[model samples]
Target: MTAPATKPQAAPAALALADDALVLAQRLGEWAGHAPVLEEDVALANIALDLLGQARVLYTLLGDEDELAYLREERAFRNAQLVEQPNGDFAHTIARQLYFSTYHHLLHTQLATTPAPDAATEDTTAPDIRALAAKAAKETAYHREHAELWTLRLGDGTPESHHRMQRAIDTLWRYTGELFQDLDGLQLDLHTLESNWHTAITDTLTQATLTVPESPRTSAWTAGAGRQGLHTETFGRMLAEMQHLHRSHPGASW
Candidate 1:
């Protein structure tokens, strides 16, 4: 008997999660060469590089690395809603970064030992997936520190800054639940992961001497299937800006 012909497979979902880190990282890049303060400007740039590194390694697994970064349509992307939200203000930007990067710290830390079946788990995802994740995990550890320091400073700094920071937490907090929720197969929602994440975030807040605003009921959970090519309006803009070159020229090379 002859073996059946196989069709070419696309990128893995977990690798696509790396895309979430990357796109947000790219958005963070906008702050580069233009942050309010010198220290933050350097910090944002470093964060952007870390994210771009994560994006490059994961995308390299499926095809040409540069093409995936500079190419591909918006609809073709599968990054999460949390990654695409607008930066709003400095406090808002830092708050969102704090929320997501902390999760990145947690998620990537887990991935080193326990990865999605399709990601590094198969042992074919790439040596870089583990390596890059390990590196990103360390960078994220610093991010957690940055966030904690800033959260305390901003949360207690000045009346106005405190108000803005608190409001930032209120505004961005809703989207956070989406992260810990079970996207089931797309993410590794380990046994009791959601509760564990809550405890973790709470513990961080305790040390920061702040609290995660209690939403009336935790904004009705809206699950976005960014992994399935589903996205919010912001993603459309992100796509246009990120892929303008490849879309305009259709595979023209540098």
Candidate 2:
């Protein structure tokens, strides 16, 4: 006899943002004991905690945070491909952080300031999203600054360091396109956000003496499929690792 079939889950905007934060938090947590310096160990841990906090808030909106984070299948995740990419080296990790933190900062800023349609309306979720954005925007500001400082240091430090920084930027450039895609619940004007993100990133790169990496051939017209639950192969392995312990012991808690 066949086992019971799994229920279908809807991919809402909050889930997408939560998955992005959760996946990236796990990636950052991997650097806990392995960071290049003691200061970075503390810094990265704090950033991971910040992302995990954001994920918890977002997950709470949907359902049980534990089950949503651990039990969901690979195809049900809605994070951008950029966050799921493996951290290749120090420069690569910084590059990823630089891109994503910048985007996150801008996105949250807009969400915080954008007024809801009707203040008297019964849609409480709008206020919650806005409130969360206000808090998250401040955290992401520090995250963006941390990445910016490291990018500058590495980009101009040495010939080898400069080369690696450039290479890292080029390698991850393709994944950046997916960050601007529209989501169901967020009524954001993505075009405006993308424009601001480009200016901010380009200015930072120039200050570091790094050229803006060329975008992928079709990136201007086409985006990655991460929002649709289509993720990179590495994401599957990461998901497995993240969920393994939780899956092994059903209902086990600290």
Pick the lDDT winner: 2
Model 2 Cα displacement at 160 (Å)?
Answer: 1.0
Q: What is candidate 1's local distance difference test score?
A: 0.69
Candidate 1's TM-score: 0.81
- Write model 1 residue lDDT over 1-254, tens digit each, in one string: 11114311223554466678778987888888778799999998888887887777666565666676666667677676777888778888878877887788877777666644655334344334556667777888887778767877887788888888878877877777656544323336555555666676677666555667788423554445566566777877876787786767876876
Clashing pairs in 2: none
Runs in model 1 lying further than 4 Å from the true structure: 1-10, 114-123, 126-128, 181-189, 207-209, 216-223, 246-254
Error (Å) of candidate 2 at residue 169 is: 0.6
lDDT of 2 at 35: 93
CA lDDT for candidate 2: 0.86
Give me the candidate number with maximum TM-score. Answer: 2
Provide the clash count, candidate 2.
0
TM-score for each prediction? Answer: 0.81, 0.91
